[model samples]
Target chain A: MGREDKAMVKKAEAATGADNRPFLFRRHDAGTIREAYRKMLLIRAFEEGAENAYMRGLVHGTMHLSIGQEASAVGVGLALRDDDQITSTHRGHGHSIAKGAEVKRMFAEFFGKETGYCRGRGGSMHIADVSKGNLGANGIVGGGIPIAVGAALSARRLGNGKVVVCFFGDGANNEGAFHEALNMAAIWKLPVVFVCENNGYGMSTSQARATASATIAERAGAYAMPGRTIDGNDLSAVAEATEDAVSRARNGEGPSLIELKTYRWRGHSKSDRNRYRTKEEIDHWMTENDPVKRIEADLVAFGILDEAGLDAVRASVAEEIEAGIAFAKESPSPDPADLERFVYTEGA
Target chain B: MDQPVRELSYAEAIREAMAIALERDERVVVMGEDIGVYGGAFQVTGDLIERFGPDRIIDTPISELGGAGIAVGAAVTGLRPIFEFQFSDFATLAMEQIVNQAAKMRFMLGGSVSVPVVMRFPAGSGTGAAAQHSQSLEAWFGHVPGLKVVQPTTPEDAKGLLLAALEDPDPVMIFEHKLLYKTRGPVPEGAYTTPIGKAEIRRKGRDVTVVATGVMVSRALEAANELAAEGIEVEVIDLRTVRPIDTPAIVESVIRTHRLCIVHEAVKTLGIGAEISARIAESEAFDYLDAPIVRLGGAETPIPYNPDLEKAAVPQVPGIVAALRDLATGRR
Candidate 1:
């Protein structure tokens, strides 16, 4: 291993202390910890596969890859039930995987096949699996924020014990929808958690340049809600923050805002030239603050899994991703004649 | 024995429809600005909060975009939300939610979901409320593919169509003329639905077909009465729904009359008239046209504050009479 990698591992071990129990180990059993690891690995592998497919000209259009933000997605997902809802953003493959979506259907959607989540109509920007409580991944900035508020309103009115988690990027924090949705959710005391994955940049416009507030979470105070900012690379921090927010929502105590300070390892989209940021900055985040390595380090320090066990997890995730891609490649293309079928409800 | 139908104003008819919907379904909710204790800006939702309470008849803050989006989300999640825009002109502020979200949600989700949202707009220009408040922009919503746009002219239709919109599995935009609120008509008691996309023939004549929508339907009828005295009988067809327009009814009317005159309160250029005219020209009715189709609509300007100018901006009864007379005669 490289000296820098070894130093990061030693630092992670030192943070665990003599008892050697990470924050995740304190809250969850070994099984849940392993599952979280699998989900995060699955997200990374799925996006890597999607990236490869895009490079090979197998996928059309562009996609926003959430490569280094797996911990935030899987961490938030670990705190909620299967029935609890989420409204995702454009960089939503990780969120989808963490929320229990079948990778094959997601791949089929990316491939524009008939068996896809949106029947190949929505493609990557609008993947939705409502049955599993993913309302949708919106193309418009801050589009899904109000929708999540509405879903929470329905949950409150119906007396259903469901909480909605809304996921967005640092860019969406500036949108009027974000403020309006947060204000309404607060006044109505709706059950919702707003998770902002602040990956530093919004399509090359850094949050420092775009946002007025020092921290995105501080804006939540204006809406009369609790807000917190934490290191997103730490999976335990994300899980703990989400658990608190979800508990408050489920208890009818209203919404909370959590700012996950992380970084993206890829460009915003396929067409993005690396002109906005320097290579040294990207390399710093990739090597020092990688979410996958942090989790692996925590697991290893706590003795949840040995090196061979970690390799086994990686191999299994790789196999699942390959299988999902193959299923997408073999899926049938939708008939052109049925283009207008889902435009409106039948017999309405 | 048939139950006696009682006379009710357009506003009362709309309120009765909401009351019935709330009573029948637990999922139905009514939300808008000043719609609770204040009873709406136009007083259309009078005393509804007392009966249904604040939870069902929600009074939202002055956030059109946010309120509209919340309604879309609520509808997608299984709540039947009836969202009211204070004025039809306010829809411009919430177009993103209406066009991109509510209209496209089902298609984007591959039909796994449906947004059963009903938005009511108090439309048209008779009131002194100038440019912003007075607009008959039903044509705008009609132009959209996924939306069902309807203009209910009478008290009976106002109640019936509102009920029908609640039952629809997709978003329905109802443009209610503000001036028609006080107009009374026979409205049947209890739950009843008027079929959307069906134009009703108010008065059938053999001379010329007068196609009109919203408040213009009543004006067309008045013009028909005035023209009948001069031996120029005019047929008045109330185009209740604009989108998914009753093309068959219009084609049949044009075929019988051999002449057509389209009237609307919106601006004439690229308005609903243009769409109707193009449809007739493409259909079998085109062969039967004796005179070129005449269109009488609003002037190409924002509604003015002056009472006379406001009246002159849109097609009044006198304007409809003159247009129909021109079409019936050889004059262009």
Candidate 2:
């Protein structure tokens, strides 16, 4: 191995926490880790800006933020092929950004402008980039799971060898679509990876109150597929598990169920009064298990980035997020005459 | 020298349409419970599995919501998936995928993509399958905006409409009458499409127009034949597609006949017939009507398991004849 690789491995090994689990940040080189860190921070900043926009009455309807679940989103995107497809849930901004959605267009969508990804029709919950293989963010709970299976079926039938990653929540695991999709993927041996981001709450209902299973991953056994639960806050762990699952799907082993144990830092939506959970609990996850800070510590321990470098990264990302909002503010609104469009294919 | 036409059953015609579509396009696939080896609940997909193999003719587990969602997903992404429900009544289990996802995906996404999905439901009451196995819910699908609901009565229209539905860019629901599957008619030899959104005049007369759908089309024609013997001419209009309810054709017919009688196997309250009656009354045909528009529909009750009750629940030839005679004779 190269000297830099050896040094990173040594530093990653030495960067283990008091819990004694080997920090495997060495899975990616320092450069890639740095890039992943930037992407996660971009998601965090963009979500914060969106929340502000909603507060300022600039956004329509409501927006579901993934402020605390950045690692799970970015890590899954890192494991996927550039041309690979994904079906996301309502809480899907991070997935869209990580899958390469243009922040300006996303902001335009939230602003309900014509230049948005869906031409302003689908706001926060329904934003999609077919070109990037982000099928769309579904409003219905567990709605996108079967869609991912169908996309996987398309890949298998078309001989594209592309894997489809399906992102849902712990509550979605209880949905019948989840069970049916997993069974179909298992029997058909379709290349799909089902990622359940267990954010510990299903719209204010605690996971304990809603779910009967100890862990969502255990339910994969019922479908006869491999399942795993990982520390979603740890970027290295999330990436490693997702890479393993993606490779398994590409190798024609059917689907793997992955449960990312994460937490959402914000309320479910703009209307949430935060009555479901305690402030102490949110602070505990935000401080001890923050994905961004964990990666910062690893970068600092490995000597790849210093406090100044981290500050620069945050500043650049913040500038980019502000520029995206500005672009969306200047974009045009859709013509009212076009309101009746898309009911059916125009020419077909 | 001339070619001779051969008679084919409605089920056989539908199977032929699917077979032709599978042969024509590699992207076309059919899925449902027991659709492969068991040839579907009504044997409409017989021999398709052997002909096209399991990959094209998929047999799914009994999960309506999942199967429908998968088909919706597949349709949006470059595949013409024809999903079959074993019975129409079970569609209630899949309303979320059909009504919410498939119906709204294109509009909600601002026309970014088209979902070319076809769903086949074995509808209507005739078999001894009782209430759960029987229903005529075409109106339910017709009420949805993005969905196109078609009910093909004859073998010819069965093959034609199924093929046409496959060609449609949006989701199309095909309500194949369970009782009509065995009925035989002269179907064309090759691929053809009965145009959607157009009504066909089954039998022409000038006194009154009998607008009907699915099994009621044949019942209306039979009623027309009986009324013709009674020296009363009844125009029989077969409404092949219900959503794009051929109002112009119905209006023109009502204007010519000066009377209207609508029939459907679904219940009378707010059924497809009600829409047809409303359209006729709201149009210029209302001024020309010599009698009040009549709606002959199924009784307001679940189809019972008893053969006699089941037969009495929906409109029959006798009922259509009686209704049309009353309208023709101006007896309200």
Candidate 3:
């Protein structure tokens, strides 16, 4: 509304160019770096448990596991302030955990427990804890992208000084809403970050088969915003890229599109046969680009802790998971009469 | 208060209503394509952007998906965002946002939220806008579960219906006919709210009940006047709200009159008349019926580019009168 902000809005559109350049990373504290690692491990463990529970019919819906992709969720989430919001994908348990949503309640939701994030209303793909600023994962492919842009626009309108990060897949980039939302964000210079998790495939369709372009991040130039492709498997690289983008957004520099180069190690969903991907494809990421292992290696290289100390954190996290399971087991299913609740976030 | 009962244009009535709403509630915000300084393509929101400023009167980008979604978001987040679609046809772009997200969010979230959003769509045919811009798709939202549909006939009803829509806790789709903007009548001087999902009998008679929606109400009344000259008395009902439809009113009128004719600008198949006729046939009103319901609606075709072709596509006053003549004389 101010003259200064209006001038910057004009300059923001003119800032975008045809240049394809690399964005470098900055160093972070050892504690912050390790926290990202433990969080990824926790996400992996929780989802692994969910996959097993779902197979046993303990959980009802199809589970979209973030088994292979964690660093992107953790790195970007760590860069966001407490008030900053994020919209995630079906493969979003990691995003939720990374954004500081309660793990016990998330597990409870999967188990149809009364103590779940949505009180058992939303299962695996719809875990939303708005109080923690996680806008919840969407069922549709590109559904939540526009919502994130809208949220950022609201922040900008009220001058709330809060940024919104929207997380979607490479498949979503093909959606009209994606382009429209990104263009609106760019035109308004709203504080929004568009994160494209290019995990090789969109459901059963490979990105190569579905997309005309070679790289998804390159398409961001059409929307006239800064775009980057990072080593999504490398925790340090993702963390650094996220910091730069988050800082730019906070400074009223509009939105940034980041393509995190990673792959889904498990099947796309619980029922996925994963025949579209070769075994070699899965093995290479498992052996070389494992995020937890990368961080564990750094933890030892810095002489901060030995294997025993790290083992204790894992054990403690596992204990918390067991208690969550117990809580989920005790949690009751929602009554049929309570069906008409919480559709809107207001006075429902 | 005794105000002059002069005829007013539909667009001017909408503008006057918006002025009153802005005067009534500070929480109300108007957002849509060209609704800002552009004053809207139809000029329904004339000069509102200048008077209310950007915060209250927003000029959103040409992204209907984002515009409607944000309006829904703002509505749920404690702001009453009255969205305007430049043309009713553009609603197809925001169907998922309106039907799936805004409409069902209340029920899906277990009644924990209230989508107090009013979507003002410049609907129906008259501008020769061709297929893309000229459409009357009210039946689409009316069929949805968690939404309310309103279509006003007179200027006073337009004011009343919009005020009521702004106050509802659910999403209300207000279908404004493109040709009805200039039709004027007695509008109250001060603040008031019309009861939604309620019908008003514009005229009382005995021979037949002619229930119409939106612009067809005026057309039906005209047909009734000509029919009165032919010694066939007809009652006209204006169904203000399409969803949670004023069925009891229509059934009551039909039971007394023993004949019914439903009229609308939309196509005959799956139109509001189809549903209302089915309701009449299934309900207790079936026992009192003297004739099978006659439904006069638009022909099945895209609104053509040629003005003549376009005019032939939808219902006209002559068409309404012909339908009424057939119903009174036992002709098909």
For every prediction, compared with the true complex, DockQ reads 0.82, 0.75, 0.27
- Candidate 1 stretches with Cα past 4 Å from truth are A1-20, B1-3
How good is the docking of model 1, by CAPRI class? high
Q: By DockQ thresholds, what CAPRI class is model 3?
A: acceptable
Q: Chain A TM-score of each model, in the order shown? A: 0.94, 0.93, 0.90
Question: Could you give candidate 2's per-residue lDDT for residues A1-348 as a string of tens digits?
Answer: 234664666766668732332334546677877888998999999999999998898877988999999999998888988889999999999999999998999999999999899899889999899889898999999999998998888888778888999999998988888999899999999999999999999998998999898999999999999999999988878888999999999999889999999999999988999998999999999988899887777777666789999999999999999999999999999999998788877766
> Where does candidate 2 stray beyond 4 Å?
A1-25, A29-31, B1-4
DockQ, candidate 2, comes to 0.75
- TM-score for predicted model 2 compared with the true structure: 0.95
lDDT for each residue of candidate 1 in B50-142, tens digit (9 for 90 to 100): 999999999888888889999999999989999999999999988888999998989987888999999999999989999999988899998
Q: Candidate 3 on A188-267: residue-level lDDT in tens?
A: 78788889999989888999899998888888788888899988977767777788888899999889989999888898
Native contacts recovered, each model: 0.70, 0.67, 0.27
Residue A302 miss distance in model 3 (angstroms): 3.4
Ranking by TM-score: 1, 2, 3
RMSD of each: 2.6, 3.2, 7.9
